[model samples]
Every structure is written in C-alpha cells, then in structure tokens.
Target chain A: MPVSAVEVLDARFDAEPDHWPELTARAGLRADWSWPVLAAQAWAARVPQLVTVLHGSEGPTGVVASGFVGPTTRRHRFVGPRRAGGLGGLDVRAPGTSAVPGWWFDTDDGHGGVHRLLAEFLPGIRRELGAGVCAALLRQVPEEALPLLEKRGRLVRKTEPLAHLRAVGDRDAWLATLPRKRRQHLRRLFDTIDDDPTTTVRTGGAVDPTRAAELLRVNLETHRDVPIIPLPQFTGQLTALLARPDVFTIAYTDPRDDTLLALGVLLDHPELPLARHWSALPEDEGGRPGLYFHFYGELMRWLHDTGRPRVSLGKKMVDLKRSMGAEFTDQYAAALPLVGLALLGLP
Target chain B: MKTGIGRDSLRGMVKTGVDALWRTAYRRVVRSAFATVPFYRERWALGGRTEPRLGSGSAEGAVSTEDLVRAAVDLAPLAGGPTGFDPVRGLGGLLPLARPTAGDGLLVALEHPGARPVWDLPRGWRGCLVDAEVDDPALPEVGAALGAGRPVVAVGPDKALDGFTDRVPGGDRVHRVPRRTLDRLDSGPYGVLHDPVLGYLGVLRDCGLWHLDWTRVYARRTRAGLAFTLLRQRSPRLVDALVGGGVPGRVEWCPRHATPVVRTVAG
Candidate 1:
C-alpha cells in the first residue's frame, strides 16, 4: 500500500508545486497537464478548480486536476446539459480537451493508487468544490483501469478511442512500420502537399494567437452542437502556450495573399511531441484537403529527425486516424455520485 | 489619544499589511480569471501579458459598459465555486428569497418598474419596484421602510436613490448609488464601496481617504483614468475595466492613514 497524504489545493493557488511538467514527462501524459496550461484553463474557468496531490513518504506520488462542472455545461454534442443546480458534478478531467482522464500515479499498484484517489480523497475534493458538487465525473479511464473504476461507479457504455502515432526510427523505417494501405495513402498525401503550387506548408512558424483562434472557431462552428471557447480566452491560452520554446506550430498558408488556411499546434517533449490542436478552412472555403495528413506527416518527420518516439494524435475521427497508422486506446467514463442519491449521468 | 509611535512607523505597518493582502488576492483573482473567464484570458493574451504583477505596465485596455451588457453571462467565471453571483440575473441572485437569515437587517432593493425584475428580496427584506424615473406611489413605501426603526439598506440608481432620500424623512440612512451600469455592479458590502462586476474596489475610511480594497480588486492608474481588474468576483466576471469618466482622485502613501490613500481631487 502506498501510504500517502492526498492534499487538494486550489489549482490556481500561488504556493502549489510546479510538478506537472516532470510528472507529465515521466507518464507521457497530454500537454494540457502542464502548470501554465492548467493555470490558463483555470483562469477562464467559471467554476472552482482543484488539484489533488497525493504525497507519499518519499515525495509526491500522483496528481489529479479537476473542476466543478455547472449544470448548464454542455460538453460537446453527446453530453446533454443538466437542469440548473441538478448535476453540479466534480469533473475529474481536463477542461476543453479530447477525452482523457486528468490523473497520473507512479506506483506499481495502479489499481490501488486509483482506489485511493477515488474512494479516499474524493470527498475532500467535493467539499473544496462546494456542497452542491454531488458527483464526480471521471472521463477517459483507460481499458486497464476500467475494472477497478467499474466496481466503484457507473461507467458510461460508449467507449471513446484515443489515437497515438509511433515514430520508431527514421522516415523510411517509420513508413515500413505502418500498414501498406496507410503507408501508400500517406505518401500520396505528402506528394500532393509537396507538389502543390498555390499552397505552402511551413513547419516551425510563429502562430498569431488571434488568427489561430479565429481559424479554430471556424473549424468548431462546422459542428452544429459543439460550443466553442470564446475567442479571447482561446487566444489567450494559445498565446501563453505558444510563447514557450518547446511549443511550435505548423501552418499551411496561401503564399499569394499570406492567408492562413490550416494550423497545427504541437507540444514538444523528449518522449512524445503531441499534435494538440488542429484547425483548417473547409474545402468549400479555400482550404486544401490534404492539410491534416500533411501536418501529421510533418509531425512524424520531426519526431524521426529529433529522435522522439511517438506523437499524441488526439481523439475523434477514429477511422481517419486509424487509416493513417495510429493505435487506439478504448476510453470509458466513470461517474461516482458524491451524495448517496443517484444523479444524472450516473447509474 | 496619540501614542509615542511616529506617523512614519504607522504608515509602514499599514503598507506592509496591505501589500501582503494585495499580493495574495491579486494572484488568486488573476489566475482564476485567466482559467475560467474568457474576457480577461483573451484580453490579457492579446496584450502579451504573462505572470502579471502589481504595477507591471502590461498595457491592458479598459472594459466598457457596452461590453459587459453584451457578454454578461460569458463574463461569469465558469468554474467559480457554488454560490455568489448568478450569471443569468446579475445581482438579483445574491440573496435567494427562500433562505432568510436574521441579525443582518433588511435590504430595500429599489428598481425602476420597467427594468428586469432581477431583485428578489431575501427573507427579512423587501423589494419595491419604484418608478424612480417619474413620480411614483412606491416612494412613500420606500420612505416608510427607511423610517421603520430596523436597519435598512437602500440600493438603486442615483436618481432613484436621490429622489427617495430627498423626499423621505429618514433619508440620512439611505445610501446613494451610482447611475452607471458598471458602478452598480453589486448592492452591499453595505457601507464600503464595491462594484459587483468589479469586486470590492475600495472602502471610504474615516480618515477622509479611499482605502483601496486590495484583496478584492486590483487597480492601476492609466492616462485615461483608473483602470480596475476585479481581483475576487467569480460570477459576472469583469477584469481590466476602466471606471468610466475617471475616478477624480490621486493615490498617495498616507503615513497618517498607515495605508495607500486615494485623495479625492475636486474638479
């Protein structure tokens, strides 16, 4: 048993440790786990944000980032908004990201760590968030972690598939590792992108935060039900993240008029460089079709050249991501009601 | 009543205490605003400001009344705890009618009959929709509430507040509120000055100087006027907004007051 003290601190508290970067690197967690990124998310968040730090006798064991999800919070098209003050749940997930659990524990007993995280320390999180927070919504629990979580809470039946692309060696070696169909399709996309005369694919360019946010908003508006982050907050978060040396952008622009058509924001880590956010103009509105694939190809090339192992290609577009040689992880959500009474989204 | 301690020593102590409180509050508000409120997050991002500190010349623009009116709900911090201001109806939700606690006294919320009936009088309180715009029948009732021996706090537009006080018998107890939308941010921290939209900005101390509410609001002097960043309000989030026209006051270190003093400059 990892005998430890789980201390829940306000995610924005000044004295909280900047342990995110180190922990993220060790666990290959997504880019949204960083202190600056979480801080940016917390600053614009309407509800209270908390970070549960599980400290062992040796040092810190794990950290879980969360916030209270208000009743009116419509998280994408699938999740319906609850009645006012009805389901003010503690969301144990990163705000505004592809489905992924916002926790990581470095222990041999993974199940034990998770048990302690949910069963022992959860009530404290609820109290900090407020009494109205009557349930905890844990998103994107991996298949391996499902058994333990399923025993304690209600698991949403649908499974979200998380995508990942591995860069085993140089460009040629990486191509060989992929399936024949995906490899050939990727080559065709790359060739088209390379031969195009009207467009220019520029990697490692400065991203104008406002312009990028506008492009993202356009992309999000394509889906009728999804609510986009207000442009200013999105721009602000991009500004902070993009300023760092490790965070870079790949842009596909119209060289003739210098208009930005597509943009891919990537976070660089020694082990995995993540393609965090991607936005492009639709085909009818002056955007080229092969931009996303080309962006992925560029990411793969960078990983090979930099000797990085893999890239975190975020959620959705499951079939498309799979056709491009990405592996999938079955992700499920677990909702544990804080109060004894059953709540919406719970069993 | 003067002690042996010098004026400078007293001032130093006040400054130290105020600075410490200001720093803690500033960090909390700024960080929270960025995380949950899109207005501040976007504005600060466009301004190229990061890791903000007091007096850091980050060149933040002022928020206008028009902006607040348009994006009132969006202005509310998404994850800001459970209770406080309600996003749908600004100040009206502060005190729900269902729950009424005693010992705090009664609050008379005066509003123009035409305005959205956002004010729901809490238990032990009363709401009278007085047509302050013109001569209305509700004035007598307001006057009656003020005269009733119980402690009463009257809040409304300047004209309405003024009209009630001028006509009412116990007008001295009635508090005059500002006409501006941003200024009427919140109703009561009772005697202290506060903007529900901008958090508590300052308190008018007995020493005849405005003591900045460093814990709840962060203010900066701009060429236009004093720009305020609400340090603590979660709902109806407003940050880096310029107090319209300009606060006609000069901020100075007052040894006698033992804190930073805002001396009102009479135009």
Candidate 2:
C-alpha cells in the first residue's frame, strides 16, 4: 500500500518531531532546512509559519516549509490582479530561501504520494488560509520533480539564474583562473577597500542588529522587486539569527567614526556556506563604492581560512557574479493552482 | 487531454514563450476539471453550462461563505498546492509608506497584531509592536523607543488602541488611525481599495464605486442583486456566490479613464 489515506500535519519549526534532522538528511536537504534558520526567518518576517509533514502508515514521508510569496515578489504577469494585478492570487513557495526546492521525500514515496499531496492536500491548505485563488509556487525545482508537478497542473516558468562560487585552493589560485582583465578588475575593487586605512572588513564580527537592518532596508530599496519588512521586525529577527552558532556576520565598518557601513550574513554548512543576506548604504551617501564586489574578496578569504568548499551566492547580478568565477544554475518557479470555481458556486 | 501538447512540450515551452504556455495549460486543466472533476461536472450539467471562459467569472451559480465552507473538500478539481506552512495564517503585510523628513522623526505603533501599515522610513524613523490583546513583553522596549521623541501613528481598532494608549506614555504623540484611512493610504490616489475577506477576496474600488475584482470574480445580475462567480479560484469550486446586500449598477463608459465603468448604488 503506497500511502493511501495519508495525513498532512502542520508543525512549528521548534515543535517538529525529534527525528526531523535524520529525516531531512535522509531526504538530502541542505543546512537551510535546519530549525534555527527557518525559525529565524519566520520570526523576522513576523508572518505566520508552519512546516507541513506528510504521514503515511509507516511514518513520515515528506517535509517542506510553508513560505508565502505574495504578488509582491512572485511578479509573474499572469498571476496578479488585473488592475493593480500585483494583489490577486496567493502563491506559497517551499523553503522561501535559496535557489532550490525545499521539499524532500522518503524513497518510499514510490506510490505517487507526492501526486496525492499536490492534487488533494495543497488545496485544503488554500481553503485553510481563506484564499480564493491559491497556487503552489516552487522555486528552483530540480528536473526530476517536473513530471510529478506538471501532471498535477502546475505552470512552470524560468526564473532568474542563481550563482555559486566554488572556493578551491587560495585566493591567489582562484584569481589565476580568471581572465587577465577580469583579475585586474577584481583586484582593483578589492584593493580600494583593502588599501584604504579608513575602511575595514572583518569576518565573524559582532554585528549591530539595528545597523544591519537599516543597511539591508536601504539595499533592498535599490532592488524594488524584493520584499523589505518593517525596521523593528527585521531588527528583532536579525537579533535571534545572529545569536545562532552556525551563523556568522561579515562587517564592513568605517574605522574613523566607528560607523557600520555594510553587512553580510552567512549560514555555515560544511560543504557550502550560504551568503544569506547582504546590505550596504548607498555609494553617494558617505558609503564605500564597490563594497558588493569587495565583499566577495572577504568571503573567499574566509573560505580559504575556514576550509569550506564553496559559497551559494544566490540570484541576480548574473553577469558580475559570473565574471568573478561563480558558476550559474538555471532556476524556475512552478505555479500549481489549488482551487476551482464550481466549488465556489457560480455555474 | 488531446490538444496534441505533451508534458515535455509544456516543460520546453517554459524557456521560450511562458505566457502562451500558461494560457494553453490553463485551458487544458480547466477543460479537464469541467469534464472529469465530479463537482464541476454535476454543477455545470444541472445549470446547462457549456465551455468555460477564462478571465470572465465562472459559468456556475453563486454560493455563500457558509455553503462554500460546508463543501470545502468537495471543491478540489482532483489536484494541487501545499501544507506545512498552513498551520497559522495572518493578514496585513502592506506597511505604511509615510516617510518622515530628516528633521521630524516618525514612530509607528502597531496596536493590533493584524494591522499592517506600509511605511517607507528614513534613518531615524522606526516601528514598534504594541499589541494590546495580551501583555506583550516588548512594552518596555516600546517605551524606550517613545522616549526618543518622535510623533507616533497608532494603527489598530479603537478597543486595541485604548488598551495600548492607557498603558503607554506619550499620550500626545499617539494618533489613533482607523481601518478606512489605512485602506485609503494603501490604495494610493488612483489605486482602488476594498477590503477582502480574510485578505483574499472582497469588493474593490472602481470609478469611485465598490465592485468585486472582475478578473478574479464574475458578477451576474439576479433578482436578489449581483451574484459573483469566481473567475480563477482552484480548490472547492465556487460557482455563483451571493454575498447578499448589494444594489446592482448600470455599466457605463468613462472617457477620462478609457475603461469600462460601473456606477453602483452601494458605493
């Protein structure tokens, strides 16, 4: 019997079952799936959070975090309201971070329990939320999961590409691989901050939550597409996140006034340390220019010192991130509509 | 399922023309639901409905929240969406967009947990969570923020704000705001504003009158008033849902805006 009459239970990250870690690892999920990171993200957003666990007769079959990406961020033209268009339909993406599907399943999912989970249960979620139009928006879904989702009637579209910088040998060895022009360009940007006595970049620095939140808000404003939460909520979330042992901060400060100018938050995974969040003041507003480019130098330096294999740089600035020797991966957003109108009454 | 388009073609179409691909896929899915899904099939057959149209509201009849809630599970079209993050759901993510000048500082007080006012703040301006339903541990921190000397904009219902106002200092700084005012601010000057049920569906402003979002709903003139047919919801399929208490309006054209306009008696 392949998971007939399965039940899906919603559990808070902290209250999840004891075997959750073993289950996650068995399903091949990364460090971002851990309780601390997910809980921190939920608390920071101040949004309601839950993780759906699929239960078959044997035991747990699958797990994924419920991350709501409203019309504000999903941005696909068809999914929004007609007038403001940005305000219609609810889209729930898995994990809500990184360029990977946060969903993981037990190998025993052989009986197409995923199809049942997708076809029947997901809509129950939409109704629970009191949403009329609900869709499952999976980000960075791998190739293997396509048929399972598509047969369930999801409209998958190509999203912006994601980048990863493999931290091999030392900084010198990595720089040697890049073209001469590209190497010189990077060196100049890195040296501008390195040589200047006024500027200082330190990895694993004690970051001021308030300052980091402000810098992040400013940086997010530059990219209007990203959702920027309120200041106090962001600060509170950052406070909890920075307290985690597996998380570290790279701070860029103006030594003269002791003002924190830029911040980068990284999640420590043995193989791939993720650069989760980065923010800086505007260049024209007494902020150092090329800080974004310069931070990668600091990241590489930390990677060499710590002996990590690579860094997941995340999406955007594809050309620039690629030029710095970061490999790119194609990403997609799959939309699976969960409700139909006949159920709402107008035939 | 016989439009000659395969699953692989749909996947391949993702890289090239996405809009066309989605429309095609939606047509196929909707067609399949009307034919295969038990709910859509029986309802449409009784109503003598034929092929369903997209963008326009459904071909079914209107239903009530009670009726829809009763048949919730029966609305699934035999497929899709999620779980995990569905345990708790909260409304209001639109923050206050009020940006205080460099000299004057603004302190936003969220008196209600559900109240989300969009705000674009400068360096000194900050937001404080001041929920009045329970004894929030952050009251002292809010007191500390108020001590910094900034004009406060308290957002919440009157009762909630009363509790907050009674407890917190700086009586003169706190300005209680109503839900309507927040709605107006959120919609902007030109954008229409209407409160949706559970922050999902409700009336929208059009030509200074209230109506359902046409793209998401289809309204038909009935003896009772206007019955709404949900255009694009997936789960429990709602055909014609009678919200009740609405006065029907005449469809008109506005030269100024150059879009179809309706003047309703309920504005």
Candidate 3:
C-alpha cells in the first residue's frame, strides 16, 4: 500500500503572518504578481467577494491564491476590476511558473511535482467557483509557463508593452535599441530641463502614511470633475500599501515651496522588477511655468542611477511610454472552470 | 413708411440694440446662476425672494446684470469646497450676469418666426442646418425643450442625429438627413474649423444655435456623467461652495455628436 496525502488550507487576511514567509518564498520561485502582500491587499479592498487561499500538498509542495468578484452568471465573463494594472481577472502563480503563463516551462527546478499537484487540485477549485466558469485569464506569464497552461486549457496570445532598463547591462547597448530620432529627442528633453536646482529627486525605502493620504487627496482634487470608479479605490489601496515595509516612494520636490511635483510609490519584488503607483501635480504659483516636465526627467534619471532594473509605467499614456523607449510584450487574461471542459461551452 | 429706423434714429436704435443685447445676455446669465447655483438660491431666499415670483421684480428689474456679476465674484471662493469640482458651482454664480447675452440669442432666434438666418453648420463627415424659428423660447426655463417642438431640421451626420436622440431628453423628433438630401443643400461654410471640433461646431452653427441648455443634454463621458450625478445629488451646499470657491467664468458645453449633447454647460 502506498501512503497518499493532500492538504488545502483557506488563508484569511489575519492568517497572513503564518503563510507570508512561505508565500513570499514561493513568489521568489517564480515571477508571481498575486503572491505579493500588496497584491493581496489590493484584492481584499477591490474585489473582496472571491476566495483567496494557500493551496498545497501535505507539508507544502505548492501554494496558490486567487480571488473573484461579481455574481457567477452564465453569460458573464470574469473581468478584472477596472483599475487592475495587468490582466483583469483570475491570476495564478506557482513555483517555476512565469508571470506570463503561456511560455515554455523551465524544467531545471524540478517543478514537475508542483505542476502535477496544480493539475489535480485545479478541478476541485473549479467546482468551488461553480459550473459556468469559462477560462482562467493569466497575464504576464514568463515564456516558460506558456506551454504548460496551454496543455491545461485553450490559449490566446497578446502583447503587453513594458519599459525596462537592466541594472547591470550596458547603457549604450540599451539606448541603441531606440529609433535614432527618438533617442535624440529623449536626450534633448533631458538636456532642455536639466537645469534648476529647485527640482530635486528623492528616493526612500518607505512612504509616510500622512503624506500618502495627502497625495491621494490632491490627486482626487485634480480630477474631481471627471467620473471614474477605480481611481478612488486605487488611492485607498495605495494608502494601505504605503504602511508596508516592502513598498517605497520616490518624490520630485520643488525645494522653493516644499511642493511635491511628482511622487511614485513602488513595490519591490526582489524576484522580479519594480511596480509603481504614479501621480503628478502642476507647479504653478499664480499661473506660470511649472516643474512637471523637469521633475519627471529627474525622477527617471534617478531610477536609472539607482540599481532598479525597470519601471512598469502601468496603464494609460501609451504614446508617452513609446517616446520613452518602452517595448511591447504580451499580457493575457483567462477564465477557469469550476469542474472542467464541459463548462467552456457556456455563453 | 420706413421698414427700419433712419440714420440718426439708427444710431439710437443701434445703441438701444447694443444695450438690449447686453442686458438680455446678462439676464440669461443671472437666471441660470440662480437656477443652478445653491449660493444664489440661498441669497435670494434670505432676501425674501422665492420661486414662481421673480427675485424681487420682473426678470428685468429683480437682479441687475451688475448685481449678478458681483454675486458671481462674491461666490468665487466656494469652488472646490463642499462641491468638489462641479462646474455648476462656477457657472451658477455667473449665469445671472452672462445669461442676458447668452439667453437673448436663443430667445430672439426662437421668438421671431420669419427670421431664418443660415449659419455655418458643424463641420466634418456629419453636418446639419439649424432653423432658428423652430426653437421654443421657454425651453431653458422649463428644461423641457430638447424635444422635436424646436424647428431645426438636421441634414447629414446621421450618427450625430442618432447620438442626439440617445443623449437629449425628449429627443424623439431630431431626424437625420439622408446622405442624398445633404448633397442637394449648398455645403454651408466649408473649412471653418478642423476635425471633430470643427465638425462639432459646424453642427451647432448649422443648427442655428449658439448656447446649449445642459439641463436637457445627456453626457456620454462616464466621468462627466458621474460628476453630474454627484453634483445633482449634493446640490445647493455643493453649489454654494462652487460659487464661493471662485470658479472661472467659463462655460463648458458637451461635445457635439457626444452621447449627450449638453452633459454640462458651466459659465
């Protein structure tokens, strides 16, 4: 007789203390966005309806956490909240799996056991979500996991653009990739606004809570007349993330009046690149030229000078990102079944 | 036996016309302010003024345009306060002052049945003519004029007509001019503006309309719609703040061919 065992644990917000280290370690195993504590907090506030967990084998062979919001209806699709930075709904990350789920798996890490566990456990997870589940939308999966997810379900490919520079690569080689005119324009932009000591960039390990709240209030003020739902939610989520040690803040300051021209709150994922929350304020003392452009240049250069490898510009401002030399990469979203294949045929 | 006034009389007439136009515009501004802004509403209430009756006298004598302008200036501090950034707060303060010129244009065009002046139509792929005679003068006051009782037959820009129906309240009568029919009309005022902006203004001009009554138009922009909803829900106090906050004296009209033509018109 062979001994057999499987253990599944439902993780709550407070239980994070026991599971955090393991979750963080597993996050390190692969470039998983959802496993981060900040992602967990975002899900909690924005889409609190879905179940989030730490699923694994008896003594912890694997770990997966997921969330869902909105009623499970036949015609409805699982869409990520409007403000979600990456693919909209149902994100999964396990050891040896890339943030982009469709790529080829790297077999060097002996991920076969975890892969087997995920395959066996996913059906049960589907059953819990209900029968109308369509596809499991995964985004930013590394090149390795693509084939694995395809083997499990139907796959679709899309390109997601990202702006990155290597912490240790040759700067000249990186700059060579940009179009000549664009490269020259970027250089000019830097040169044109490089002067003015009044504009200084400051980077720090953590964000102050009071300052975070103030920043959020000001952001709302700027867009008070515009109507959108996700902004307020994003502000709340950023405020919470500011209190965490893993998050950091970079500010472009106007030394003359102590005004914050632009502030970016970034989350450090030592296993991958840095993710950022960005906001800016126009510098006008009685309707004159402001430091918005100058501050932005200073901040980007500061990040370059520091060892941070890349910056996720996130959503909106696609044209601006292209001007800055960001390349487009594939990002994907999928829906998962509660039971299995039979549900895929639902509308 | 003179169809119009003589030269010496014409100068007097011109001065009177100028003064009348100025006064009418100012009255419209004030009326809109009192109707939309809560601070003005409160001011009127405290001054023992009430609805169904003019501020203290007829529409002309009750509140002078100068008084309305001063009120707007006084209320400028209220913007961004309790009202957040609602445009109504700013516009309400200025409506009493600006409405005379703004409102007169509409009223004169609508009240005169035989005066059919062909203005430039909104440009671009979509364009239509505005027959001023059909408009209802009372529409602004009652907020019920978006319906077909207004006389403008729009030609070309079928989508714009469709958008009007969807966006305007009681917009069942706004009919689209078939492409064949538009080719027959003299292309009114080409090269006036560029792109969607030109196209938009062309529609307004061709329609023979200058100002928009936001109370009747719908806003398609989700953010704008939400802002309007929030403003409506929190009126008066929010209106007061907008007035007191010193919002600029600018009017924001809804985009033409937008789902709702007049999502917001702030003065």
Task: Rank the candidate models, highest lDDT first.
Answer: 1, 2, 3
| Interface root-mean-square deviation (Å) of every model | 9.7, 19.6, 18.5
Candidate 3: CAPRI quality band = incorrect
- Best model per DockQ: 1
Judging by lDDT, tell me the better candidate of 2 and 3. Answer: 2
lDDT of 3 at B122: 24
Off by over 4 Å in 2: A4-16, A21-40, A43-47, A56-59, A68-96, A108-134, A147-154, A226-233, A339-347, B1-267
- Residues B102-214 of candidate 3 have per-residue lDDT tens digits of 12112111112332232322222111223333443433422243232433323323444454344445545433332111112223331111111001111223322222223
Per-residue lDDT of A1-347 in model 1, one digit per residue for the tens? 44347677654444437665666667666555666766665554555466777767876677777765675553321111111233487777754565455776776455534565565457545544456767677767666656666655465544567888888666566667778988898778878878988789888889777678658766665544434342223555666677777777889998898888999888777765678778898888898887887887777778877877888787778898887778987777777766763343222
Each candidate's TM vs. the true structure? 0.55, 0.48, 0.43
What docking tier does model 1 reach? incorrect
Lowest summed lDDT window (length 10), candidate 3 chain B: B191-200
Q: What is the TM-score of chain A alone in each candidate?
A: 0.80, 0.76, 0.62
Cα lDDT tens digits for candidate 2, A1-347: 24333333332223456767777767655555666545544432323345666666667777655555454532211111111112234334445365555556665444233444464346544444455435556566555555666553458877778788998677677888888998998888777778999888888878876567657756665665645422122443465567766778898899999887888988777876788888887777778888888888778888998899898898889888888899987766677665563353211
lDDT of 1 by residue, B235-264 (tens): 666666665544534556555666554444
lDDT of 3 by residue, A205-244 (tens): 4444434534544554564442322322222234445656
